[model samples]
Target: MLNRNNLKVWLKSVSLVGALWVANSALAESPEEKGLRIATERKAADKGWGDSIATTKMILRNAHGEESVREMRLKALEVNGDGDKGLTIFDRPRDVAGTAFLNHSHINEPDDQWLYLPALKRVKRIASRNKSGPFMGSEFSYEDLASFEVAKYTYKYLRDEVVNGEKCWVLESIPTDRYSGYTKQIVWIDQSHYRPQKVEFYDRKRSLLKTLTMSDYKLYLDKYWRAHTLSMVNHQTGKSTDLLTTETQFRVGLEERDFEQNALRRAR
Candidate 1:
């Protein structure tokens, strides 16, 4: 019903409209937007774990290869609007036995942490400024053991690469918390499973400080993923800590009250 010229013009208009729509959609999402979106999606996917329990053996090594072992039990609860709560109870290493630590993390506020010392029969609230200190002589800081919340960091997608035969997305996360020990952390997350495989920590001076590698992940409830072994190597001190999880159980029916200070005192 139309001449060749008319039909050509009509096709060109439709093609132009499609092109414009694609361009607009692409422009709507910047690199930062895309990075945050990826982080949010990964966070959402990891939600609903309910509760979990794990037994960990932490082996600390000094520069000269001296080693000390500490065994502990960990219990965690997922909160709705706030960051998750966790309690760690020390069992072995007689010097530190009957010691418990509790942490309550918030979205934008400094985390509330307490240490229960059976020797003193008192609960010592950890100062926000001291959260950067190592936890019980381990390489992991108190801040490192807190539950990872997306709001705690601002993310920037770096690139995609293969790590240990797994395809991973490299992401740089700047801590939003001022008291964080590290200037920034670069993470390698597996693309297929959304599990973190490695992280490099940069110190306050923007120098390479430590590297953490997680492996031997096992799936729980057919959805949740947890790494069984976490190894942290301190570059400056030549110290290392390896946390081997001997047992892990999810959906332990843990309640909010179980992570309170009173519960910490009664942990042993």
Candidate 2:
């Protein structure tokens, strides 16, 4: 047992195993780390747009196949280190005309939302507890309309899957907000451009509630990719809503004052 040759061989084997173990450990990546990296990259891909204005037509459909159209104008201002500010002014349908919705999204905090009802002629505060409710009878909830900040969710990289012929990374994002309507959301984001192809929202009971599919992506300002066609379908109620952007202009000289609730009341 004390022979020099035998001792040398034993030491060599042990050294090799130790070296391999170190290499493998260094190469391995945790799912949480990878998920955060992917999400951060996705967010980084859509930065540097000072402001934007878009004209969108919302098509609401019932289970009975009837459709109603509402035209709206959207204005947004980018905020650094926080979520953006948005204002939606309804312009069509005599009943909903002059109605406005104001939102100021933030990171790691409850969003500030207000709705101006034309009939009431008074702005209604949208409480955090009520954010899970539908927005104007649409499939999307008030919380869903807020800007998606990275810190709002804890992400997990599930696996790679093909979505609508495009290979994408299937990511599971759990909302950190306790008042969020959904238990979790699964998103299929394309690996190439980091654009989301589809998203599935789960209800409080962990049941699938709604699905949103984005298509017809067009690049704005040669940097940001905007989906012109957004279709959201409710699996529970069999209702659907489509938002078609008729026009979009970036760097529209908009400022924070334009998104204020006072300005919304005056403009409407």
Candidate 3:
């Protein structure tokens, strides 16, 4: 017969083994669930931004290395729903003053984009198919201007690596949109903060086409994290664009009324 002390020791060992098994199982999640978790994390990072205003400077460099700079003051208002909507006004340059960019996104449909150029004094709908094209002669595509929602793509954990001196999780993302210019994307996200540090985009030919670097991240509203500088480099064209967000203010009490089509004309 087994002694009482031996029986107690055996039970304790089994309990420890069961606890470890539960922990290991929790670490292993389904692919879809992992993708959703990543999206949820990204959404949480920007949760407090009901509205915002900012000044932006866009610098464009051509393949021949020619540089052009544009400065603009922006008033942006955002609303949350099944999707999201944002309206931004551009106030700069003698000719493009009072220009406006309106964006409306739906989980089911391609994002609807409209640009009102003061010189034309008319609103032009930006075609959804043209999202892959350059934006105003800049390296950034029209799609880049849209806010990144996690639902836009599916993600897979590729590996773990070090980026910018921090441990990071390397993930591969495939855009669900059939018209997306990129065939696939590789992103490096900081492990601790879950912030995207870098992304490499592949063209339809499955070639490395462009790279995006995000830096100068700051915490807004003590909860939201924002990248102050974003740079896009086009490998094929040898062109690039630097987007510097000089100012950003959140929760400014902006309303949906500020995002209407009619409001675009009167935005400035």
lDDT of every predicted structure (CA atoms): 0.89, 0.87, 0.79
Error of 3 at 77 (Å): 3.6
lDDT order of candidates, best first? 1, 2, 3
Residue-wise C-alpha lDDT for candidate 2, range 1-268, written one tens digit per residue: 5699989998999999999998877577577777888999999988888899999988999998799887999889999899999999889877789899888888877778888887777888776554788877788787877776899899999999998778999899998888889899999999988999999999999999999999989998889998899899999889999989999999979898888777767656
Residue range 163-211, candidate 1, lDDT tens digits: 9789998889999888899899998888898888999999999999999
Candidate 1 residues lying further than 4 Å off, grouped into runs, are 1-19, 22-24
Stretches of model 3 off by over 4 angstroms after superposition: 1-24, 30-32
Off by over 4 Å in 2: 1-26, 117-124
- The candidate scoring highest on TM-score is 1
Estimate TM-scores for all models.
0.90, 0.87, 0.85
- lDDT for position 24 in model 3: 79
RMSD of each: 3.3, 4.7, 3.7
Among residues 3 or more apart in sequence or in different chains, the pairs in candidate 3 whose N, CA or C atoms overlap within 3 Å are none
Our tally of clashes for model 1 stands at: 0
Candidate 3, position 140, lDDT: 81
